[model samples]
Target chain A: MKQRNEQLPPGIRGFLIRMGQIDRRWIYLAVAVAIAAPMLARLRFPEVPGRMAQATFDAIESIPPGSRVLIAYDFDPASAAELEPMANAVLHHCASKGHRIALMALWPLGKQLADDAIRDILLEYHPEKVEGVDYVQLGFKTGNEGVIKLMSTSIAEAYAADASGKPITQIPLLEGVRTIGDFQLIASISAGTPGAQQWVQYGDSAMPDAFKFVAGTTGVQSSQLLPYYPKQMEGMLIAIKGAAEYEMLVTEKYPVTRSADRLALGRERMGPQFVAHLLLIGLIVLGNVSMLAARGWKGAAR
Target chain B: MSADRAQQSSGAPKSDTRLWIALLIFGAVGIFAGKLWRPGPLAEAYVEVVTETRVLAEVVPAPTTQGTSTDVQSAETVAPTSLEQENAPTTRVWVELDDPRFKSGELRRVEGVATEVWDERAKVDPKKAREQIAALESDAEKLSAPTDPTGLTREEFEAREAARMNALKVVESTRIVASPRDSIGIWIAALLTLGIFSFLVRDNPFYKVVESILIGVSAAYWMLVAFWSTLVPDLFAKLAPDLVRATMLPGLAPSEHPGKDFLLALIPLALGMMLLWRLAPRGAWIAVWPLAVVIGTFAGMRLTASIEADFMAQIAATMKPLVAYTSSSAEGAAAGSAFDLGGTLAGILGVVGVITVLVYFFFSLEHKGVVGKTARVGVWFLMITFGAAFGFTVMGRITLLVGRFDFLFNDWLGLSP
Candidate 1:
């Protein structure tokens, strides 16, 4: 490669070499433009529900209406940008189906995120639903997976009271909910450890057939979780693409009359994502081309 | 060395010039483009709802000739004493009332339920007042012990009691009128974001300041959250339920086995205090005991969990038949025509991939024969997996960047798209 570069004219060879070593700031600017331009133009492409997305939808839809469902929020504000869309859609889906919802958190900040979802999605769309009767916030407990383990045996022991300090015994929704086994379905919107994986190990493993489980995870965390899908986890949604696809399926079935944009966050975010992926692909290709060019045609072929 | 220094000094000016020119171009282009695509006047995404405040108490119906009237009593009928209001348990509820501010026949649900309404305060539930007041008096007596186990001084204890009393009173009645967007908070967030982004150009004091603030705030925030969420609920509440319920956690439910729970909780509390002793001038070694316990307990828990969840489950999942078949439909299964080609190929590929990857890790054989070829195949499979992972990571990172940009444009600049 050095010999070939030396053989070429200094200007052309230097340019070719420089292509790989261009200041990273320039690339950052290009990315910014790629993302911002599409966002400004509102370039959204229609999302078609994929296999995993359809499976996720079916997981929620198959559950009997008014069946007890627990949604464990396991991500904080840091991962909310990626996970919130799916969280909103899933909450809406469950509420629209009239499933008795119970919200809890493994991550400390997860409770705040759950509160945001309840205020923005659940209460906004389903105003007629009462808090203690139709839904309840068990809030954040200190123990990570230990909470799941305890809940697996006895939920009343795990959380003595709801977020508001209301005793679990007094909560009408939790009348018969002695254990995690009482819930018909469980969904974990998780980012890392003490999350969906913990739920699967401690909660699901305790009573495998007691409840159906589904998970929504960030793209980076998806690889570690893929093996559990379709078996241990009945459905899985990976990253914003999965969220967008799932949102399409959910909104089609249960459309909101007001603030429809709240549910369209995932689809709206895909515009920038689409352009940014293209830009990344272009950069990857350019990088490879530069390498090949520096090697010369004969060397590249070899 | 002198010549190299001279060359570097000479090149610095050119580099600086290039950077400035690039910045100018970007700035000019961005401004012009934004102007061209400007939607309209800036609009805040959140709207303030105007609401009025009212305190309603749940009163027991009076007995009548035909039985108690099931109707809820008017607020005027219930006039509880200040002491009763201060000590009684309360539940906050929102009631939608007629307001001229709302559209005709449209009721605005104020205060408690909706996010738009603000300053919805707790009102005492008179029904539970007698029991709660008795519990409070009992708890106060328990707290008035000779030695303060919680390590609070007399002044602090008195202050806490005063705060507790204040917390129980009906909060000030204030109407939430419409106001402008929270410009101050938005500006602070926007400036900090920009400061962080400035590092891409070059490290500067602005970036350093923002970095320090973020680190300090996050550390303090997490500490407070942990103390309240973990220590208070799990340790302190268990040990002194009455005191905790009265002072710190007003909602702490009555423990069934208070004596047993207190004894068990003491173990952790003692260990925690011992761990904190590291900050003392002497006896720092006490911290090591808890440290060992933590590590040992963690290791023991992880061993069984990992073996079950990751090791055995993965192995079981991977051990699949190469020649796979799936039932296409009920009719097709009845006719014995459910040989799925895709499923078969996928099964074969999965098995081959796993085997080759394992072979690559096996170092018993020399790399001069078919073993080397199989190892190379494994390398290909490994590379493909890594490529996919890298792609996903890149996608995730880009999404975060998109989120930041969204905040800047939509929230900060009030740009809609």
Candidate 2:
């Protein structure tokens, strides 16, 4: 390393050393371009479905038609960008399969997110579906895992009324639903605590084999849930990539022609992702090179 | 100090024009290599390639009704259809526009004010409220079985209970209109997003303002949710009956499973009151009782839950067959050979990884010789996991950044896709 640094011209050596200490603003600009360029260019890439995403898709597909599926939307607007695409794709697939959606939230703002999904997917694509009869919103309930514990025993105890203050008794879809076990499947698109982990601890452990459980979570949270996948969680979708892969599978099976833009969102978003990863790799390489050069210069001076 | 100054002057870093030229060359070459590079045959043995072309078909918009469908089928009338046509209407209900039962009017405001006064009275003269409650209890004990739970007659209680249930039913069926969105809200959100992103440049007043707003809003939101969901509904509505429930709910007809909800609610209500009573100078020590109960309950629940779910469950899942294959060739060995070998190796590695990682955390057993080697292996496993986690974190952060850009460009700016 010392010999290589000495062989290089003084100007180049100085330049490398200076680049090592360059302002972070330049790095930020590079990142912005890395993300924005692909999006602007409409860059598209082919996604080969991963095992986890494939498992998530299969878990939902295996459920019988018109079967009740509890979607615990345990995220807020902050995480919407990461989790929403998968949420939309999953909901679209479920709707196509004619599943009865029982929407609930453990987070406060999660109720609004559930409503957004309902409005964007359910109300948008499947307009003929009635609110109470075909789908029901239990709204946001506090108490975190305590709410899940209550629902495991009795759904009504936890959620007395829907988000709009409608009694659970009046919901036609919830007529025979007494406990979490009544549902055929439960999918939690979670960002943090009182999320998939809570569902597994409270709901799954309470009544194992009663209902299939799947999860879609942020990438950072995936490691925590990794041990449970293909076991406690029959399926898992990690982050945006998982969302894109799962979207591909769903759209392939049940294509929503007019809503192609909505369905293609996850895949479309992957373009920026690939570009950003490349940029990160470049930054890491350049950073290391700079470090080595600086070290060599120090040693040569010594 | 003189030696340090001489050293700094000799090896001082300086910017040069060659850096930009070198960076441009490096970037161009890197891009070219990325585009052109392919794995060798050896790499192909461990890699999988899958490619497909897909076309998104255009859907003809179905002629949907503009207004509410007049031919709406009642939930009772629509029979369950097969999975063939999912769109077929399965269930619907006739929602009356002017439903009388939903007239649970602005009675809650009156109840709120009354409850505040009653709570203040209870707070100021606890002994008086206690005696009044004891007298009311004695009067209730003297009354006949069917008289009434409170001071009201059985007939009046029943009638009020029915009315309250009706009001609840009406409120339940009510559909709220969607809140309209305007450009102002979008602009505010955009500004906030930009403010947050500004931190990447440098800490600024804009970022501070956004951060402060977020902290303030989150605190206020939690307080509001706690009040409505827990304090008001669970505690205040149940305990301060005369002021809130009697006036607003008007005798919330005892739940079908009455004792459970009422008694279940009572414990927390009393505990919450004790927590509030800690504000008093005299019985401040009494606060520890509720605090202990909460701590004990939470600890017990979390302990059992974490032990079972995070510990035992993970171990059970990890306990997989080392060799995944049929015992005999009659079950077909050739077709399953590859999968079996892969699964067996993975299972063995998983078990080893878990054990070594555990050993790495075992500070009691000094790492030397064989233990040192194993611990070193454990470190590698940890590093690999951390690396993967870091990569995923990068992906997550990038996705968020992309979302912000999408908002600024698409939603905020109306940029064409």
Candidate 3:
């Protein structure tokens, strides 16, 4: 019965079908243009740092120099674009502060994320720093919160060795450390399940007084983390806006001294976002105008 | 999975039992062959055990004479010291010895060497405290003697350390690290992977597992959380405090007696548990009273927060700057650190968008005159918003797909590293 609606004039019928249903690829094409146009032109837009992102930057800044901070690359390569900027900005901020980091990952590919960060930022830029003492990569273990729970009790039991199979006992940075609580601060940069919410609910909530925690989350997952913020979570960075804001804060205060700048990524992306938002608004208005014209002028045609 | 449907259609069920049997047999044989076939890596041990035991001699709270405390945890390696050396009064001196395990078993039998140092302040008069300690040492020396140890003296010490490690096992579980949860390899886990994704098609048993996994995950989270959050902090940290206060000074804000408070706490706890009675066929309706307060409070909180956080706050933020329409104002040129031209436009559009969206959802009020037209406009705005949101989400997914393609084509193929 609904198939009868398929037969109509091209533009008018297209409008009608769009109002109800339409080819998804057309929408994809529109989105691609919306994104690519700004990128091709190398659009630049100004961004005012959001309060939450500022809070995240400030929280990391407040840590004393030489303090141990664990950065959990809890997301896989899938969310690299949305989350990598935040992670990069955070790494720069921590390195700028001279905070010792013990990099680790909950997701397997997260280790690769750490490796990429190390290769891109750490290995080339900060070549003077020593591993196993200055900063360590504890690598990855195969237990979700089970590992969290284990490390909380006894880190040695949970992880006896580093990713390279060297005993953790040999790592000078991990000396006298018993659990996640030993770290001066912990940051979970993640996307979805086993991400920020898991960190907040499982890790932070378990021992609120033990360690300070902050999260970098995707936009969809941000609202869920909000309830735990300020009290449970010291700070939270949400999606592109959050990343952009955080980048602005970190760069303005403690600028990086190399290529692959963070502030530019966030600000560059914001230009496309602003333009895309405008385009979307226009589309809605046009659709409404078309609806009005079709209804009102039908009598004139008759 | 659809054997019954197939039976009805074809007058017989597909004989897939043979396939299952074949798979089981093949898997078992494959595992056995692999075990027998695989070669082991050739490598030398990186770590070598040095001293197998150390005597925890005089461990003073603050004595400069004592050398640093090494692994004196395993007491036995202390050489018999002269009166001058023993009476030097150091904090904690871990005496060195040869790898005692390689030596005679008698080398492992160091006993009654105090592994703990309380405080130097506790010994106000060292001479007198030493006398008292010597007297107590005689008594404790006897007490330290094993009535019936399960093994040799060395084994007893090993057992003690092992027990200490075991007691610490619970605290070990509370650790938060970025551990890989790479459970069931990518290919072998297709059952759960496909089962979870099955919901995109329709709800069924496959979908049920996915839904149940969500609940199971939540339940497991709370189970671990409750122990560390409530049991450890509340019960462990407060164990001594709860006792000391009740014994020394009564009449505190919360009762110092954990035992009594614990009993009183059970009233609400039991009442909370009673709500689960609804799971039963009979007497299920009895759970309403218990659930009433829970449901009511939940509704109250949800409504109060949603209206304020979502509706009112958003509406208030949507208001345009006065300079948006006022060309004479300085605010016309700058808004929120960006040039005001775009910001002003965005603000005005946001307000109109919000109003239109609300009009669309306003089903209670009948459409009339401008209302019908305004509501129609609202629907268009909402549809556009949904479309935009969907498009953005798809873009994000496509980014992930592209990343996977990049991994396969670039990283693995060494084309893009």
Candidate 4:
């Protein structure tokens, strides 16, 4: 045979190089299967909600009925999937409790989130609640935390009208509202600061007992925020679990009146969540195992 | 990336004509949205009415809990509407504080109430509020001024600002809005900002030392969070404030309670001040005494909480649920429940895979044994997580870049805007 330079021994090369180069699409498929199978099968993993989620739920629940509650929407489309349910649930619970809600946004895009939440949840569920009275949307303001600090004392300085350009003074819900402390409680569903921490710092810290406050945050942020829970923060809901737990709380006692399906949207999403969490965990382990196998074969070859 | 390819991409620019067309569309929307963003008459009246209703709702039981979309989307920050947009009888910055929905009379009342509070706060602590009002009012004036000192000499502008600052009225003391809460918040805000600033000094021992102090302070903060968030709500909200006062301190005045108002502020305050000493040469040595005490307390508390919340609790949750083993099938349904067996299995497998991958990290032990071989297998699993994380992180970074690009290309020159 003509001399040829083969890369390596055929069998060894096949195992080490050929097999090792598994297509990423296969992994994606595996992930899809891993996630979908559970939903199809209805796998029920025993999970008790974490304390942070419970605290968050309880914070919303604990405020005296009919108290003034300020809910700041601070996320965009990307975070809507994870945050919307809790945001909706929070709005639902507050509305149901007859709490006056002062709605506003911190992010430019956050306004859309507020608008979407209002259109989908409020109008659909609580049509009896009138705008500027049962609730008022101060719309979007651009000052970041400086707004919080200023509005802590002077609402007129920061906001004079609802998002539609209506004067807030006419709104029945915001009648006496002069400062951040005027509200009995502030519940911020935030992806990050100038959202949660800002409220805790500039909002809560500014007023102290003026209002009880809490937040709903993503899991990655929960670790950082854990220290704030139950103290500086009256309650905290961490990620999907927190959302699900809060959803359960709102729906349990006071269910959404309009859409029978609305109550369970968050819990329903948990199906995908469980699958996603498991998928990430699986990917982590599989990647580790493959490395070990590759290393072992390399060492043995030597 | 290539010109042809760029053109093929729908959003990419093609020719000058197309560019102009796009710009026209973008400009129209931006101007309209930007201009009309100012709250109008009808909207102003609506919000005023809503405020009154909310006032009553505060007294009733369970005020409507459902959040509204229009309300939620309304504000991003509380900063007053910008100076530029606030010009004349009406203008638009990123926000609008004036609207026509309310009778001018109603708005005047709202503004009057606000001014009353400010004036009251100023009266109580004239000295402090004077500074705050002066700092803000002058800034507002300068920013809003029509002339802008456009061609003024640098020294002149400085002199103008200084003269303005000097003209600011000061009194002995004003306690109206200057509550202990305000003081604590301001103080803490200053410290937090400074603490973050210290990090910018780089790796000097002075910086590291301050960082360590912050960590230690943060740890103490963790305890306070736990105690106040968990214990207080569970306790205080349930019990009488009087009971806490009697039991904890006996004859505890309103000011003495741990959570009473803003009393616990000293915990963060004294420690924060001590941290500042690290920057000063002489006080550096003694600064550590306070640092040690806080560090020790934080370390001890963190140890317990970390174990209970993170480690032990996590391990406990990991055990396969009873239903997983009983109901799981390859087909995967044990229906009616939200829990998914396949997902749980994936989790369980992930856990196992992690153990194997960890073995790969240890190169010390010879792979002659089965354990060593498994360890080698484990390393592969770890890479997958890194890859995923890398991909996700990259996506996040790219999004930021896209935002910057949007600002430059679209927002700035209105050229491709």
The DockQ ranking, best first, is: 1, 2, 3, 4
Per-residue lDDT tens digits for candidate 1, residues B129-198, read 3344566556555545444428888888778877655544322212222124454566788889888988
True contacts kept of 1: 0.72
Instruction: DockQ for candidate 2, please give it.
Output: 0.67
> Model 4: per-residue lDDT, tens digit, B1-417?
366445445432245336545654764486456335532211010000011111100011123535322332342222234675563322111212332322322222222122111122212222333455566555656644443577899898888766655543221131223245444444454444434433332223345556777799999999998776555544453345556544543333343454554445455546767888888978597688788988899999999989987788666655654334434455655553466577678777767875686677667877668977787667667677666555434323322323332222222222220
Best by TM-score: 1
Indicate whether candidate 3 or candidate 4 has the larger lDDT: 3
Pairwise TM-score winner, candidates 1 and 2: 1
Model 4 spans > 4 angstroms off: A1-21, A32-47, A295-302, B1-417
DockQ of 3: 0.09
Superposition TM-score, candidate 3 onto the true structure? 0.44
Q: Individual DockQ of the candidates?
A: 0.71, 0.67, 0.09, 0.05
**Better DockQ candidate (1, 3):** 1
Compared to the true structure, candidate 2 yields what TM-score? 0.65
Best by DockQ: 1
Better by TM-score, candidate 4 or 2: 2
Q: How well is each residue in B1-417 modelled by candidate 2, as lDDT tens digits?
A: 577556544543234224544654775585445334521111000111122222211112235534323222112323345764556543333333332212532011111221111111101112223344455455444432343448888888988767656655544333221112334566788789878876664455678799999999999999998886667666666555445544555434334554566677888878977888889989898889899999999999999989987799879878887776643556677664445676678889998999899889889889998888899899999999899889889988988888887876665554432
Docking class of 2: medium
What's the CA error at residue B335 for candidate 3, in Å? 37
Report, for every candidate in turn, its global Cα lDDT versus the true structure.
Answer: 0.78, 0.74, 0.62, 0.60
Question: Which parts of model 3 are misplaced by more than 4 Å?
Answer: A1-27, A205-210, A261-263, A298-302, B1-417
